[model samples]
Target chain A: MAELWELSAAALRAAIGRGEVSCHEVAQAHLDRCAALDPRVRAFVTLTPGTALAQADHWDAARARGEALPPLAGIPIALKDNFCTRGIRTTCSSKILGDWQPPYDATATRLVREAGCVLLGKTNLDEFAMGSSTENSGLFTTRNPWDLDRVPGGSSGGSAAAVAACMSPLATGSDTGGSIRQPAALCGVVGMKPTYGRVSRYGLVAFASSLDQIGPFARSVEDAALLLQALAVPDPLDSTSLPVEAPDYRAALTGDVRGLRIGVPREYFAEGVHETVRTAVRRALDLFCDLGATVEETSTPHAEYGLACYYIIAPAEASSNLARYDGVRYGIRADNARDVIGMFEETRDLGFGDEVKHRIMLGTYALSAGYYDAYYDKALRVRTLVKQDFERCWERYDVLVAPTSPEVAFRIGEKAGDPLAMKLSDICTIPVNMAGNCAISLPCGFQDGLPIGLQIIGKSLDEATVLRAAHAYEQAANWQPRVPSLSP
Target chain B: MPRLTLAEVEHVALLSRLRLTETEKQKLADDLNVILQQFDRLQAVDTREVPPTAHAMTLTNVFRADTARPSLPRAELLHGAPEARDEFFVVPRVVDTE
Candidate 1:
């Protein structure tokens, strides 16, 4: 029998709701798994076994009283470190906020609690969600569960790794330029980034306000949908949160893709994609065609400009958003500084890691007095072109298909010194964020013993089609049952 | 390609209020130059009539109702402060004496 920790969130929810298992038992199973695996995986920044058990007991007690249970009651879920959890440390994996705890919960956190989900702990990430690898974490790098020497693709790396290793069945991740999808792809899990504004960003540590979005990582597409259902409520606190009613993401997973139009963007396959990844994605596309979906080559001309546009735009926004982290209001303050300027400089200099500093410098330069038009404005115009490119592509096709990342997970420290090389891993995923569309990355096949991700992207707010196609492929691909082998 | 000199990096760091070590400043200069050079590709695409997209959503001016609601208590809000003094954040003096 599969261990309780390895069960899908949907399965656990059903078991808990049917009274087949107590919530405390489920929480204990996962806590024991974490205690056994976390030393090697290092997926969590902090573990909340005590709180998890207590919450689970509360659910069990409520069940004894014949109270109605929420959809996700008693499911142990992990939050990416960037999401603020009241009275729990929300570090964004940065040294600056390392010891700081939030005074209130993020909208997503509050929603999960309201649904009676047990909080496992906060997972690790790139400091301030900045890098492609969790190596940029001010704490420590989370190893890929498939291969500890290699990195779990990053920013959301720890969350993906946690789910992949069965440390948690469902976890929340924020994607700004493929943070969630790439890591999910690399770790052999299901990760979906809902349309920008589909989920509220209230209380999420802002890396780039316009681009950042919270989503879920799970072992299966249906489990991902289950978590998304709990998190998809509109929030009044976030101005960008869409007021549109969320569809039944779980109900939409019919596992049928017949007559679905899949567009294969020529730009996604042009160069840099590894041969193994290309083969796996191409095979997956062929399977879609075999399943009665028509696949056609489509053009997205400005797709090549996505990374450049994102780097410019995200950092420009980050430069403004991160200005609040000065020594005054919250977070670590440099004690030796004599004046305000010195304090701000010293505090940030000590608090932020290298990648954060690099982006801040780039953003500062891009948004500076003289270069604003030449850099930031130009990037925004290119952003419009990129969006238009997708809009035109969507006119002909229902959804686009592409490789989630160009290659399998690289060894840790391989691209650590090269920023451009690390940025290249996000090539396929950034354009989706740029267009404010929904996309999902699922394990299509294994390349050289490592998993490859196939990305299915949908039009703005059209997560149903994306999820449907992904579910169909996932059901046919039969890759969901595979788990990483971690030897103690 | 525009070269980001060490001096310019220092200037940007100052603008960003980040105190970088000499090594980080040099590394950042090279990294920024490489990234800026890559961004130079945007200049080739003629966006003559294309308006800039500042955000992904089309909704503009999202205003909430003007009704008073309870907010975080003063103590709660101040709890995360690095240093607090009697319900207020403590900061270094901004004014300088000649």
Candidate 2:
């Protein structure tokens, strides 16, 4: 029998709902697993065993009293440290705000609490959610469960690693540019970034406000859908929140994708993709065809510009958003500063990592007075063309299929020295973010013992089709049940 | 496009309110130049007639009734401040005592 910690969120919720296991039992099993494996995985920045136990006990008591419960009631979930948790340290893996605790919960945090999900703890990420690898985390790097020497894909690295290692059944992650999907693909799990406004960003620490979105990481597509169902609600606090009603995402997973249109973009499979990853993704496309889906070659011509466009736009916005982190209102203050200018310089110098500084500098240079029209403006225009390219593609196909990353999980420190090489890893995933459409990355196959991700992208607000197609493929593939071997 | 010089990188750091060591500034100049060279590809596309999209979705002025909501309590808001003095955040002096 699989341990409760290893069970999927759907299975755990079903067992808890049926009284086969109490919520407390499920929570304790995961807590115990984390106690044992987290040191190896380093998935969490902070563990809240005490709070998790208490919440689980509350759910158990409610069940004993025969009170109605939410579908996710009693399920344990982790949140990336960027989301603000009331009274809990919400570090973005940056020392600047290492000890800063929020006074109120983010909208997503509050919604999860209302859904009766037990909060396991906060997980690690690239500092300020900036890097493609967790090595940028100021606190500590999270290792891949498949191989400790390899990275687990990042900004959402800790969440993906934790889900892959079975430390939590589900976790929340935010994607600015493939943060959720690339890591999910690398860690061999399910990650989805909803349409830009599908989830509210009321209290998510802004990385690049226009591109950033909160999503879910789970072992199975159904669990990913369930978490999205809880998180996809409108919030008055966030102006970008969509007013549309949240759909029954779980119900959309009918596991029958007959005649579904799948577009394999030539641009995504072009140069730089490893042969093993390309083969795995191509094999997955064949499986989709066998399942009655039509696979066709499509072109999103402007996608090649996605990386350049994102690097410009994201950092440009980041430079502005991060300007709030001066030494005044909250967070760390640099001592021994003679003036405010000196204080701001010293504080940021000590607080931000190299990647963050690089981005801020690039943004400052791009948005500078004379260069704004040349760089930032050009990137924005290219973004329009990119969105239009996707629009044109979607006119012929229901969803686009692509590799989540150019390659599988690479060895730690392999690309650490070259920032450009690290940025190139996001080429396959950034276009989806640039277009502001929904995309999901699921384990399609493995290459040399490392998992490869297959990304399915849908039109704006068309996540139903995206989840439906992913679930259909997932049910047929049966890849979600595979877990990494942690034993030496 | 001109390659970024070390002095240009230092100027950008000054604009960004960040302090970088001399070594980091040189390294940043090299790195930024490489990245900018990659970004130069965007110049090939003709966007003269295209309007720049600042946001993904079509957005307009979003407004709510002008009613004040309860804000976080002063004590709770100041809980994370590095230095506070009687309901106020303390910071370095903005001006020198000449």
User: Taking the tens digit of each residue's C-alpha lDDT, what string does model 2 give over A3-83?
Assistant: 899899999988888789999999999999999999999999999998899999999988888899987999999999999
Q: How many Å off is the CA of A134 in candidate 1?
A: 0.3
TM-scores of the candidates are 0.99, 0.99
Model 1 spans with C-alpha error above 4 angstroms: none
Q: Give the lDDT of residue A172 in candidate 2.
A: 97
The stretch of ten residues in a row with the least summed lDDT in candidate 2 chain B is B88-97
Candidate 1 TM-score, C-alpha based: 0.99
- Residue B71's lDDT in candidate 1: 86
As a whole number from 0 to 100, the lDDT of residue A142 in candidate 2 is: 97
Worst 10 residues of 2 chain A by lDDT: A479-488
Q: Compose the digit string of candidate 1's lDDT tens values, residues A205-241.
A: 9999989999999999999998888888989999999
The DockQ of each candidate is 0.84, 0.83
Candidate RMSDs in Å, in order, are 1.1, 1.0
